[model samples]
Target chain A: MTADAAVVVENAEKWFGLNPALANVSLRVHPGEFVALLGRNGAGKSTLLRVVARLVKPNRGRVRIWGVDVARDPERGRERIGLVAHQTYLYPGLTARENLRLHARLHRLEGAGERVAAALTEAGLNLSADRPVRGFSRGMQQRLAIARATLHGPELVLLDEPFTGLDLEAAELLSERLRQWAAAGRTIVMATHNLEQGLEGVTRWVLLDRGRIVTEWTGDSTAVRSRYRQFLKGAPPGAQGRRT
Target chain B: MKGLQKHLGLVALLAMMAALYAIFVLAPVELTMGVVQKIFYFHVSSAWVGFLAIYLVCFCSLRFLRNRDRQWDIRAAAAAEVGAVFLTLNLVSGPIWAKPVWGIWWTWDARLTTTFVLWLIYMGYLMLRRLVDSPEQRARLSAVVSIFGAVNALVVYMANRWWRTQHPQPVIAGGEDSGLHPDMLLALLVTVLAFTLLFFCLWKMGCDLERTRDSVESLRRTAQRHLREVR
Candidate 1:
């Protein structure tokens, strides 16, 4: 049962001084579930994603990634999870292939050369694989970042504002990649401000307000925005109502 | 833990008192250097504390890398900062003592040059942290620099022993006898203890300040986020 779930967060509370970031938040994500975290800015969407990534520790409660408790063993937990934040955690001095190769070597993965080659090909940057990341376009950098983050083929992936600076074509390509990853049964959780753009393969939508999960809905993005607007109007602080 | 921290300040004060009494009243003045040699006790004690700080920075830096814990980074940074202040004291006192005895205020001897370089390395470590915005990145870079600083510190300590320079030879570890009055040696030892305790007390304060700075930064970000949301 423990191994079955991809991510489990129970009673997780995070605070920065007196200001609360996550307030008694509990969530469970099954394998292959593509959960899209939605909210206005300062809604703690990024903070919640960071909590699952084990980048920022919670003040109270537990976070388990692939049955491994993050507090007890962060390194092992991190091995199963990949984080792709707004800033690509890549060295701009290195080439696309070199960046991927360096990360693969750091993780001590087998068949590093072939893995780097395959990741570059998969990200559609095979021809420009040797080019330095700094010289690449914004879209190219983000795409390479996505590939670098999933280099070790982690079971769970957390993305924060990945589509922020992408053009239409680049956005389409990233959305297509997301669809493929979801279809392949990888657990994907993305924190996005654009509720409309990347909901094609998203299985669930969870809206957060002031660090609280006020509402969640499944199946499509058809009425999610309108419903969210209505929810926002009546939503006082510490309010809760879950929609399935 | 709170009680222990509170009592540490009191203990450090009492130790400093004993050290002062021993230096001024108990120990006899040197026939050659006269009253100026009294500062030697404080100077040597500060150097000892500074060396201790270097070791701590190295240990904490390695631990931060191995354990991936932020506390270690805070500790290493604290030690380096406190070490720098103590080293400055040593540098200033050395010149003041030298002006009368050696007929010169300063000399670029091996000991002095190496000690100055050691100070520069720590300043670089502190400057690197300030330049970087990301906490994780700052910690990683500073840890590597601190490890290198530790290696340099060993060289600085051994420079006087290895090279024949204007600096005086070792007194405590020089041959069978230290060639000193027993009370003088006793005063020096007590002063070393007092300085060590004082160094630790100041180091703890530095760590606490860093921790508080972290909290303040986090809170500031949270406030910025809320302000934007309100806008």
Candidate 2:
């Protein structure tokens, strides 16, 4: 294991009784790597991220977050991982500051008040900190979601469709922040449907046709794009056979 | 936790049975209602458990809202379901016991009216879960409802004390009624313990079932993915 490998999975298998959701899924996320998880609906993107976050357990595998087994130390393991999804994961009735303060309390952070202020400022949400989240627009709410994710400063960030409802400018601003976070040596794994957005800031790509990873590439956008298109065309036809 | 889960249902069942036996075999017949007073044991026990369960749900939900652990949400859900069942029994048995003792199947008494309102509030909570689209939304929304329901429960408990009622005066020495006899009090305590255990067992089972359902849904998604790839 390298120092940069923020996440390591070995033979991870998750199943629902007789049905296997993720089979022998193995991956390594190095520090500062912005990797995109590309797969169609029901492609195990959320499942994979949830397993790493210790939100769900794998049937037969080991996931080590920064060399700590999540099963053995879920609380400690979670300290190093943060997750953001399409949902705001916030209380609509509470002010942005109050909502962030609640999470800070859960994380048991000292001086949470100052940290929350700093995070809100960094996310360009200083103007709306005292306002209720329900009053914010979609893009503004999304910014708060990012601020919440970065408040604790986890080593690895998992984003599930961070750009789902964003305007082009909002998308670009968030994309820039994503790059900044990764540049600070934090690992990022984002699952998105927008190939154009997914392709940005990502050096390594893993394409999923179904549950299984049909192919993976380290670099060379041209080669990766060509392979991606081929997988897209050839994937659906052979998807059922590659499931196991 | 497992010990708590294991004994939860059993304790309640055993206590209720013991109380029933004591009511019939040990405690002498009441001067007023004779053998019909037996219903009081289970009646009070159900109300005790029902109120306690809802209170527990409120506490857990507050913690869940404070902390975003979905586990606390699960605990709250368990408490709500168990609370609903026992509260139903509380309301139903009250009417049954009232018919023989008070000569009426239904009463417009303040306590009974407040309890019915509580039952309606929780029923709405259950309905809200079904209407929600996502788990995150479900948990947050449920937490808010739980807090409101809990506050309503306090009002229900105080309804009789808060206002004078047309209900019959208490026969015992506490508030409207006199205290129970030594034997009756012991049996009542035992029944309370038994019902508390039963509530835990039922709650644990419900949580386990919910987790299994979530697991199965994720599994189906996985299977569907495999089929998609093969197509």
Tens-place lDDT per residue, model 1, A23-127, is 988888999999999888878989898888788878788999888999899989888888877788888898998899989988889999999999999888998
* A44-64: candidate 2 lDDT, tens digit per residue: 888888989988777678988
Task: Give the Cα error of residue B144 in candidate 2, in Å.
Answer: 2.1
Candidate 1's C-alpha runs over 4 A off are A9-26, A40-158, A180-186, A208-215, A230-236, A239-244, B1-18, B56-79, B104-114, B135-148, B155-177, B204-231
DockQ of candidate 2 relative to the true structure: 0.11
Query: Each prediction's DockQ?
Result: 0.07, 0.11
Q: Is the docking of candidate 2 incorrect, acceptable, medium or high quality?
A: incorrect
lDDT of 2 by residue, B1-231 (tens): 767556776666776687667777777777777777777877788888877877788888898767556677778888888888988998988888788866778765666777788888779988888899867678778889988988987877587655644445443223214766888777677777777777777888888887788778878876875665566
True contacts kept of 2: 0.21
Candidate 2 displacement at residue A13 in angstroms: 17
